[model samples]
Target chain A: MYQLTTVTKRYQRGKQTINALEGVDLTIATGDQLVVQGPTGGGKSTLLQMLGALDRPTAGSVSIDGTDLARLSEAKLTKVRAATIGFVFQSFNLIPTLSAQENVETALVPLGVKPAARRKRAAEALQLVGLGDRLRHLPSELSGGQQQRVAIARALVKEPKVLLADEPTGNLDEDTRDEIMGLLAGLWKDRGLTFVLVTHDSSIARRAPRLAVINNGRLKVTERTP
Target chain B: MFFTYLRRELRRRRKAALVVALGLALGIGLVITVSSVSTGMRDAQDEVLHSLYGVGTDLTVAKEAKAEEGGSAPQRFKIEGREDGEKASETDDRLMPLGGFDNLDDSVVDKVAAQDGVATAVGALALNDIKFTGDFKPGEMKKEEGKPGSGGGPRVGGGGADIETETFTVMGVDVSALSVGPLSSSKISKGANFAATDTEALKAVVDSAYAKDKDLAVGDKVTIKGKKFEVAGIATADTGASTSNVYIPLAQAQKLADADMKGKVSKVYVKADSSDAIPAVKKAISENVDGATVTSAADLAEQVSGNLSTASNLATNIGKWLSIAVLVAAFLLAGLLTMSAVSRRVREFGTLKAVGWRSGRVVRQVMGEAFANGVLGGALGIGLGLAGAWIVSTVAPTLTATTGGEQPGGPGQGGGPGGGGIAQQLGEGAQQSVDIALKAPVTLSVIVLAVVLAAAGGIIAGCFGGWRAARLRPADALRRVE
Candidate 1:
């Protein structure tokens, strides 16, 4: 569970103080699926960064399980991110040099898992993502949909409590985007994970049970039926 | 996983890695070559110094001879049979007190030996034996007709003379302390060295070259100053120049040179307790012993000139600085290139951090790649260094070193007619210039130094790249890439 209060993020761009986020309050329960939707430069990614513990808000309290992430040291925040959060980028940011299995295994490395077990778990995760036969393929060898699946496998391999994805389907066509969304939904349901996704596609946002629409650093949440 | 990542990364950037390695290799190879050549220079200098003062001698004490002090004097030979009305007469003349140096009392040796840091002090006399054998005919001098503007003088008519001069160096050794003089550097090639009992036995040691020239051997007799002496041994010098043509007992040399030279010596060779003690001993000898001029091996090394000295100076000055400059440039290049590599991989590192890899881990990955490059460079550099040193030793020309005769106004300079002009012509036939073959020997220490330098270069480059990686914030990195 995450509790964010009065979350404000401000940055400078050529002597202009742009408010990336302002007075935003949010709560995400365990096993909740939240989809954040916004246009370009609309603070959707900034909110997701706060939730992922990848950046500290300028003036706010972001709490996970009653622990304020904003008050934690950088090293402690890193540990929290390593153990509890997994991130997926729009470009399917898999290591270009690593194969499918090795890219997934990197998520388990920080946990000090032995190499043999890490390999076994990574192979299983790849198999779950419908890329069991593509374990040795580089990121470039995979198509857009297949690369998204590899990214999903890497994000889920660590078995984190939360998954944060930024524009996860922005780089794919309609057919591939629907296929990736189906895989993510199935995995989220099976594992009962808290999944937060940032996207600008209304088609993808329509499927979320809760939608947080952000514009110019302000947010509004609405409930809907999937 | 770390090694696997490092290996893959290095393979992907093989060309850049090779460039960095080759740069480092060039610097390291030059260092090794210059170091080995410097070692060779030192060895050659030691060889030359050993020829001058022998191996055991640390310093030599001698008093400079003045030109007008009878150090060199014209010799008068009595031509007999002139009163018997003989037209032609053959004369043989032998001159002593050779090499033209004033003698010092034997007490100076005792004084030097008693000084602090002095291990042993022994004295030897350096002499030159010149024999003149020729025919001389007596002729009458008549009054010469004077030209209108010329001076009138008596001139000899129908007189002719033919003369032949043979000269050789002789060193007198004190058999009791023969371990620190000219004879100390020579090895007995035939027969044996001077024994204690041969101090007054009229025994002599002939140099190998001198013996070969005169067809003399052990047990044969040679005439010196009208005295026949038995040859006890034939000796060959160790390096540089031969010591002397002959070695005889100090007592015999004194008797032949002068009747009043019973307890006098021309040169004193002093050995110190240790190399570090040499300077102090030299100072003490100079301050306490009157009129003594001390010459150490270091002093003689400074006087060396010609190709060997020039090469040695170049190796120490230009060669050393050139290696340093190349090494510094290589290190800067490596550091800059490594940092640039880290900059190019910012997104990859940021992704790793988001997936829970610590900053230390990211830095280590960068450092590991840099270190691998360093190791590769080190291996290649060692091979190149060995090859360079080999080529130097094989292809370098022979170097010649000449010692300076800078003791001005000293012996034999102002001798009247028939006197040799330079001391080199009289003093031990000292070959002022010596030829030495240049050798570049790569010792174990030089190899170890090369390894250390290579490792240091790698570590320094790694530090440069790792610092860049460790300071990167994942969010900032990811945002920059986006």
Candidate 2:
């Protein structure tokens, strides 16, 4: 479960103050899949950054599983990001120099996992994402869809409590996008994990059980889908 | 775990890593080569100095402008200088009544020998008035002539005039005390050395090189000041060092120079009990003898060798500083290269931090790569230094010179007037050593220092790059690249 109480985030760009998220308030219960829909520069990614403990709010608090993210130190925040949240970017940020399995193993390095166990867990994660035979394939050697699958495998390798995807299907073809959406929905239902997807596309937002639209730096609840 | 990531990065960017390593290596090589060459030159100069003043003779005592020989009343010879006057003029107060030029009394030698640190003291008279006579080829004497007045060598004839007799440098030593001094048995090359029991007969020993060139063997008779002397033996010395062609008894040399310096020695070879005691002995000799120009062998060595001390100083000071500047530049170059590399990979590091990597871990990764590069550079530098030394030694040029200590055929030397052979023979002191090869042997300490420097350069470069990496915010890094 996560909760945000009027969280605000601001940045300084050459003497100008830009409000990334202005006193935004939101909350999601356990096992909730909230899809945040927004136009370009709508602060949806900023909101996701706060929820995932990647950035601290200028004001207000973000509570995930009853622990306030804004009050946590940088060290504790990193720990929370490691154990509680997983991120998937639209660019499929898989290290190009590493193999698919090695990319997944990166998530386990900071956790002090032994190499043997880390490799075993990484392989299983890749297999779960239908990249079982692509263990040794580099990002450049794989298709865009396959690279996205590898990125997803890397995020899920740690078995985090929440999954944060920022336009995960924005770079994929329609057929590959449908497959990825179905896969994410199936994982959400089977594992009862909180899924927060940030996207500007209404087609992608329809797949979520709950939808929220963001304009400027403010958020509003749109609809609840069954 | 950091090593795992770093290893991959290095493998992926091998060309860049090699560049950084080579830059550091070049700096290290230059440092080692310059230091070693300078150090080697210093050592070689010391070796030459050790031979010049006689191996164990730590101090030498002489009278200024004093080795004057009497023609009839024994007071005609004296070097022309501010301290010396015409010994022939009895009214001149500057000229000592007796033993004017380089001639110090036996009593002064005894006093120096009795000093606290005095091990053994012997006396020798430098006489450059003598010449070797044998069947000679015409023009050979002119070709084998030594230059005069180099490194304060004996003053030959005032001007130029070839004498019928080709003159040679000569030394008169106390026969009984020669055993305990620098002219020990080791200096004898053939026949036998002058023994302690050898009386003051007409006996003499010729330097081996002079003996060979003159075809004069042991037991051959030679004439000095018209007095015949039996050649007792042959001796050899280092090429650049000053050694008279003939070594005669102290009494005979005194008689040859004349009555003015009679019963006195030209140079008192004092052997100190220890090297550290030379200074104390010098101080003691100065206090004991009046008007004596007492000089330590070290000072004499410096005075005798041309441009050696200056060259050593320039290399150690100027060359060392230049090498240090190069090393710093090498460090900065490596830093810049690594910084450029890190800038290009900012996104990779940003992703790593977003996952779970701490800032310290990333820093360690950078430093580790730098350290590796540094170690590789050190290895390359050492190899380069060795190769450079080899090339220098192999391509060195040979030089011929002489060590001229005394010239006797001057205005009043043994009453030889207008005889210019002294000027012709004075070039003997300019070491005839053709072996001018520079030995730049790399020492262990220098090697260790160079290796350490290489590693330090790499680590310093890594620190610069790591600082930039640590400042990178994960949010901004993620947004920079696709």
DockQ for all models, in order?
0.73, 0.50
Docking class of 1: medium
DockQ of predicted candidate 1: 0.73
Model 1 preserves the real interface contacts to a fraction of 0.67
lDDT of 2 by residue, B339-369 (tens): 8888987878877787877778777888888
RMSD of each: 4.0, 10.6
Q: Which TM-score value belongs to model 2?
A: 0.77
User: Which prediction has the highest TM-score against the true structure?
Assistant: 1
Worst 10 residues of 2 chain A by lDDT: A200-209
Residue-level lDDT tens digits of model 2 in A124-218: 99999999999998899999899888888888899888998989999999999988888888888888889999886778877666888888898
Off by over 4 Å in 2: B54-163, B170-208, B216-242, B246-314, B397-435
For model 2 chain B, where is the 10-residue window of minimal lDDT?
B89-98
Q: What clash pairs does model 1 have?
A: none
TM-score of each: 0.89, 0.77
Q: iRMSD (Å) of candidate 2? A: 1.4
